[model samples]
Target: MSFVESRAAIAEALSTVEGVTGYPKRPTTWTPGDAIVLVEQIDHTLGVAWQVTWRIVLLLSGDEGVAIEQLDELLPLITDALQPLVYVDTATPEAVQTEGGDMTAVVILARSE
Candidate 1:
């Protein structure tokens, strides 16, 4: 699928997940990738948007910071959500920011995992 299509698919999938997971509904957006910043918006809660970076997609959960090991366990769940749309390269650790609120995730998908 094209970038926009892929983004849309991912976003749709995330919405379903949110509904089933009982997470608050949030607005989302996507930016076309070029030479830099190859990312697509998956979900957005508040001003914080969940994005998929090209090189790597970092995913997180819980109110407190998640450890690397814990993150590893969560990858399959994300992959399960994304695998149907397209191939997703395994997620990697990116910047984990805990500034104003609880911990969230930013998944970066290159091609497939």
Candidate 2:
């Protein structure tokens, strides 16, 4: 269960954050809060060697600016946590917003050196 381990690592990195829940066994039944950040399992590339990118989604209950700020706050944390691994590319803002809140998903690419 590499994905599970990866998810766990991400959770451990984000432990200090006020409210964040990594891949929950029961997402439908439980949620962190209005400002929720979920670290999804790593999506792997099917080929000779396996490389992955973690999809970290942020659902904030504030204005778009607030959401972006939170996203910014998490990036370095994530980068630091995944020490051996690294961000594949610049975070594409795909930063979408909803009523009174914002949602941003950053796909971090990585390889084991």
Candidate 3:
């Protein structure tokens, strides 16, 4: 699939997780609660196939402790939802300070070809 199509498919898969809001594109305004943001990280030609890497940011609005707890709860669900769609290479917790608020983000690296 093309990169755009792969991204859309990944978003669709992410939306299946309960209590998680999936964004195909970055939102102008952040959501109030838990959400997932899909970002295209890189794309390169691997032999005849094109490999696309996507950064799936799982975000929660709260302090580090609480947000980490919430993200921990959601991680398995997110991985399960993504398993059928893409190859999940890594999922790492990160502290992010956004204009909206202090947030915890689980940055997931996934790839598709």
Candidate 4:
């Protein structure tokens, strides 16, 4: 799939989450207290048709405890919400920091199978 389509699908899935701005949007497009920003990144096509690896960066503010908790809680929730987009079951997350708050890269490999 194309990168645009991949991000659109991911954004759709993420929007289902409670309090999450799931629709693909630039961080600047959102308001304050959004809790987290789902920014699509480094997405490209897989060797196979309809398959793609999507990297979503979640920007949130908090400490390690809070960051860990968000990752733990959102991972499955994000996975489950991706209907029709097969969750790869091998994606992982990386933690980081930003001027806005804590951040993590949630790598999700999916196929619109």
Indicate which candidate wins on TM-score. 3
The regions of model 2 sitting more than 4 angstroms off are 16-19, 24-26, 29-48, 85-88, 95-113
Error of 4 at 98 (Å): 2.3
Better of 1 and 3 by lDDT: 3
lDDT by residue (tens digit), candidate 3, 6-110: 777787788788877777787666653445545566555866766777888777756777777777788888889988878889988877778866767788898
lDDT of each: 0.44, 0.47, 0.74, 0.54
Total backbone collisions for each predicted model: 10, 0, 0, 1
Per-residue lDDT of candidate 4, residues 48-79 (tens digit): 43444444555433565665676677767766
Weakest ten-residue segment in model 2 by summed lDDT: 29-38
Q: Which ten residues in a row have the lowest lDDT in candidate 4?
A: 31-40
Clashing pairs in 4: 15-22
Error of 3 at 90 (Å): 0.9
Error of 1 at 109 (Å): 2.5
Question: How do the predictions measure up, each by TM-score?
Answer: 0.45, 0.52, 0.84, 0.61
Ranking by TM-score: 3, 4, 2, 1
Pairs that collide in candidate 2 are none
